[model samples]
Target: MVKKLHKEGSLEPQIEDMINRINELQQAKKKSSEEMVEAQALWESLHRELDSLNGEKVHLEEVLSKKQEALGILQLHCQRKEGGAQRKNVLQECTEQISVHNCQVTESCRQRKLGVQVEEQLENLMSQHKDLWELHMLKQRLTWEIRALQSSKEQLLTEEKLARDKLLEVERRLRSPPEVGGARMVNDGRRRWRYSRGRRLPQTVAPQRTRPAKERPAPSAPAPAARTWSRPQTHRTRPAPSPTPLLRRRPEIKARISDRPPPPASVCSPIPNCFTNRS
Candidate 1:
């Protein structure tokens, strides 16, 4: 019976130790559960933080793409503006050159107009000079003609004086009578006689009277013979004549002439004949 008590007592110590261990195990289980919950909460929190970081990264990438697109648009706008400015500069330069060319053309036209006017004035002056020179030449020619006329008048006057002197000398000799007998006869016989009445009367007067008398006798003799022959011939022609001589009558010609207009009164002035012996 004592062995039995000793074993039961040992079993009680073992049972008490098992109980203490079971209690310790239960406390450890409770602490392990609390640690697992804490771990779970931390893991959930880390997953949430990772998702937020991914969304932030996507947003940043979209912003960078928008900035790049905006930069490209700005660069294209600047290039277009630069090209427009260059074109405007070129147009302005061309406009300025055109204005300069126009100014030069206008000036050239003005100079040409002035040159034409000057040329015309020069031509006019030259023409006037030519006319003046021609007029001066004509004046010189007229002066020479006047001098020639004066010289001709002087020559005519000299010739007229010589003729008058000769006529006067001739008249003086003709009017002077010869001295009769003695010393005058002896002196006259020694001198040449230019107009002795006895010597020149036969040569100058006898020939003049004889020429007209001889011509008168010749015409008179021919006229009588012609009249005698014409009278017989006219008598013979009168009997054979038809109407030819009657158509040629002098009375018909006189009648026709009297039918014409009279002389003008200005040319028909009557003049008194002072040499007529009307008293």
Candidate 2:
């Protein structure tokens, strides 16, 4: 009835309004279709996300179940281990205590041995030092003795040199002549002649007593021809050897040295000690 009324009155206006309503409905339908398509795509994406989440959950649940089983096994093993470890802990504790005690005993023994060795070493060193001191003293005494002997030897040498020089001087005096000037004369009651500067001098004779003429009858035994007197020639005499030359030839007098044997090995050598084991 209303459409008939609209058709009778202004049907063209009603038709245009109807057409606009239809176009609006068609546009709403198109918008609704687009909205439905977008919703469907969003729903599909959400469903896919849900499915992946569900798969991850399932996997996680399965892993959890396995882990729980493993945990149960571990708990049982732990119970067994706990029961066994009690005896093992006690045994280990005892072994450690024994080892510690042995180490301590060894340390004490080593310290005592080391102390004894140190004392022995100290004693040996002292003995060696004493021996060295004695040797040093002996060397000093010997050195002093040597020096004294050297000084005595020097003195003897000097005295011998002086004696040698005196001997040589006496030799020189004995070899030379006593007088060097003109010839000497010996005037006794009778005259004595001597050579002077390589020439012989005339001798003066003493006066003789006169004989009586009466006693002289045999003059015919003519007096022997007057004896011609010639001067005596001088002769050279050999000089005697000087005794000083022979006396001065003194033999080389060396000091008499007694050979002394070396000291015994016991006195000269050091005492021996056997090597000790370290372990």
Candidate 3:
């Protein structure tokens, strides 16, 4: 209907109204482009703030690691101090034990010396006892010898007295002459006197008798009878006694004393485990 009106030249009012609506659309497009440019500038500012916060976190982590290392070094120094005290106590105990051992060794040496002295005294006493016993035996032997000599002297005295009594009896008998006739008794006395003087008498010394010529014997026959009666035996024989044996003498003895050597000493040393284990 509007196209029919324009062709007939009755449409001037409708054409002016179309040209005003086209100008209003152009102004709204220009205002939307200006708002998009402002939003892009705000996004760039937020990205720079996030990068600065990351650098500050890294620096804080390095500081924490250094503080932990310093605490560990302090703990190690405290443990070393406690170990030194324990070592000093062990050294003191070792010194005390060594002193006790030294005292025991000194006592043992003194006892050994005393025992040696006692043994020497006992040996001397035994030797003295043996000497005394030998002297007593010698005294007894001398006493026996003296008694034997006294008994022999007494026996000799008795034998001498018996010989003297026999001699006196023979002298008394000769003093009283026998009466055997006149001339015969006188002749016997003269013969005894001649025998005492150690002289032999002749056969013809008797007084001559007055005999006839035929009664006298031949001189040669009477000579043998006279010789047999002239000599008389006087001495007697006695048997000899057997001799006594001599006594034996004792042998000499020598004594010797010998000393014994001291025994060897033994020593033992213990291994030190404490020093080896420490290494």
Candidate 4:
């Protein structure tokens, strides 16, 4: 019975050790699952941040475009207002002068109707007539001035229209996708590198050169060996002969005939060999 108890004691420790090992494995598995969940959550947060940043970028671009358009319109309006103010000042000055001339004419007419001295009345009437003539001349000048101002206003309106068109063009360009302008999509880190390099990217890619299957030489063929020349063992002998000059042959020219007879001579001659003669 003592021996049996010894065996049982040994088995007990072994079973306990096995249970401890299983518990450790279970705990490790649980920790691994928890870490995986944490990693997934971090990735999702990063994705959300990226999406938010993209949206903000789009909003900022729209706002900037609108601001530029508004500034252009405001500038045009300010210029128009300045021109109108100048015209208004000229009109106000003319109005004041006309008012003074009317007052003088009224006083002269009143004195003449009251039958005071005829000579004095005649002189006053003459002065009034002179003032009337001046007023008539002033009216003609004012009419011409108004016409000129109208023309200037028309010209300014045309210029404003052109400016608006140009601004619209600029805004359209801004609104267009950057890819359409051959601009490259850059990552946040890469943009800094590009700025530091100060190099503009290529606007268009050249078409790739391709060799037709029939035109391509077989690659399995071995390359030719380089040529070697043996030098003379003796001291410097005769010098080498000079290279012969290469001569190019000139291309031959052919005369072409037309199928129809040429028209009668005119100021200009008919084009030569326009049609092929089949006969």
Clashes of each: 0, 0, 0, 0
Relative to the true structure, how large is the alpha-carbon lDDT of every model? 0.54, 0.58, 0.42, 0.52
Deviating ranges (above 4 Å) for candidate 2: 1-8, 86-279
Q: RMSD (Cα, Å) of candidate 2?
A: 23.4
- TM-score comparison, 1 vs 3, better candidate: 1
lDDT, candidate 4, 58-77, per-residue tens: 89889988988898889889
Model 2 pairs whose backbones collide: none
TM-score of 2: 0.29
* Per-residue lDDT of model 1, residues 1-279, tens digit only: 447657677666666777898888888888888888888888888888888888888888898889889888888888888888899999999999999999999999999999999999999999888677666655554455445446544643554465456546855754453223211111211112232211211111111111233333434233322111123223335343232222233345345434543433433333332213211
lDDT of 2 by residue, 150-237 (tens): 7545644665576567655644643342221222122223433332222334454443433354543356754433333444333333
Q: What would the per-residue lDDT of candidate 3 be over residues 1-279, giving only the tens digit for each residue?
A: 688867888676655655565555555555555555555555555555555555666665666666666666666665666566667667767767777777777777777677777777777777666555544444443344334334433433443344345334534544444222221133321223212111222222342233454644556543322211223323233222222111010011001001212121221122232212311
Best-performing candidate as measured by TM-score:
1
Error of 3 at 3 (Å): 31
Q: Pick the candidate with the highest lDDT.
A: 2
Return the lDDT, model 3, position 258: 10
